[model samples]
Target: STIAERRPERIAGLVYLCALLQPSGATPADLHRHDPDSALVAAIEMAPDGSATSIRPDAAAELFYGDCRPEDVRTAIERLVPEPIGPAMSTIDTSAERWGSVPRAYVRCDRDRAIVPAEQDRMIAEVGVDVVVEMASSHSPFLSQPDALAAALVEIRDGTA
Candidate 1:
C-alpha cells in the first residue's frame, strides 16, 4: 500500500517497526516482514486490524519459521491476514512516529528493488537520519557489496561518516 493511503496509526506504527528492524538482522528483506520479534509486526498486532494475525514469527529469530509465506512476511502481509475493519475503516490522522532518537547511517544498495533510493530518502528525512552512504548493489547490500557495506558500518561506529 502507498504510505499516503494508510491510516495514521498504521503509519506511525511502521516507523517504530523500522527502528526495530534496524538491529534485528536488518537486511533489506528482514526490515519488511511479519515476524513476532519484529517491532513492525508487534505494532501490527496492536493495530485494530491486527487481531486476525495468525502466523507471527519472532523478529529476532536466527531463522524464519511457521506458516508464513515469503509474500506474507514482506510484500503483501496485510493481504495475507484477515481484516477487522468491516466494510470500511477511517483514514488515520497524522500522528506517526518511529522508534528512534539516534541518527541513522546506511549502507545503501543502489540497485535495490524492494527499497529504492526515493523511498529511503523520504524515510531518512522523516526519521531525522544524519548519515547516509550509498553503494552499487542489489536489495541485499551485504551480499552484493559486503566490503563497502562493512566499511560504512565501521564508519558509523567510528563517527567518521
Candidate 2:
C-alpha cells in the first residue's frame, strides 16, 4: 500500500518487498496459482493488532523451507516472529503519487525460490527503485546472508548506492 494509505506519518524512504508484489484485491490463492508446487497459503491466526499470532506447520514449512537450505531454514523457523499485516495493507497502488515521491531501494534475492528471480525482477521494474542490490541468497537473506544484507541496508541508509 502507499505510505499515505497505510503509514503517512513517515516520509523520505521506502523499502518495498521485492519478494511478493500483488495487485489490488488479490488473495493468497493467487499465489498458489502462480506457483502451485511451492506457494502455500499460510494459515495465520490474527491477533488484535493485525499480527499473526501463529502460523500453521504446513504454512511455515512451505514459506521458510521451500527454497532455503535445511540448516538455514531451521534457524529461520526458530527465530520467526509474528508479522504485522492488516488486510488493507495488501491493497497497494503502485501508481500513486505519494509512493513515487519517496526514495526507494530494492534488494533482489537472486537465489530466492519462494519468490522466483523473474517475479522479483518484474516487481522491481514496475515499482521503480533508486537503487538495486543483488543478494546471492534465498528469500530469507537475513538468515542466509546477514552481513551482506546489513551492508546493503547501510549503503541505502547512506545514499551510497
lDDT of 2 by residue, 11-104 (tens): 6676654455544455433543655455433355566775555565556656545556778767767877776565424544544556555677
Task: For each candidate in the order shown, give its overall lDDT on alpha carbons.
Answer: 0.41, 0.63
Which portions of model 2 show Cα errors greater than 4 Å? 4-9, 22-72, 79-90
Index of the highest-TM-score prediction: 2
Off by over 4 Å in 1: 1-100
Model 1 poorest ten-residue lDDT run: 12-21
Candidate 2: Cα lDDT at 111: 67
User: What is candidate 2's local distance difference test score?
Assistant: 0.63
TM-score of each: 0.40, 0.65
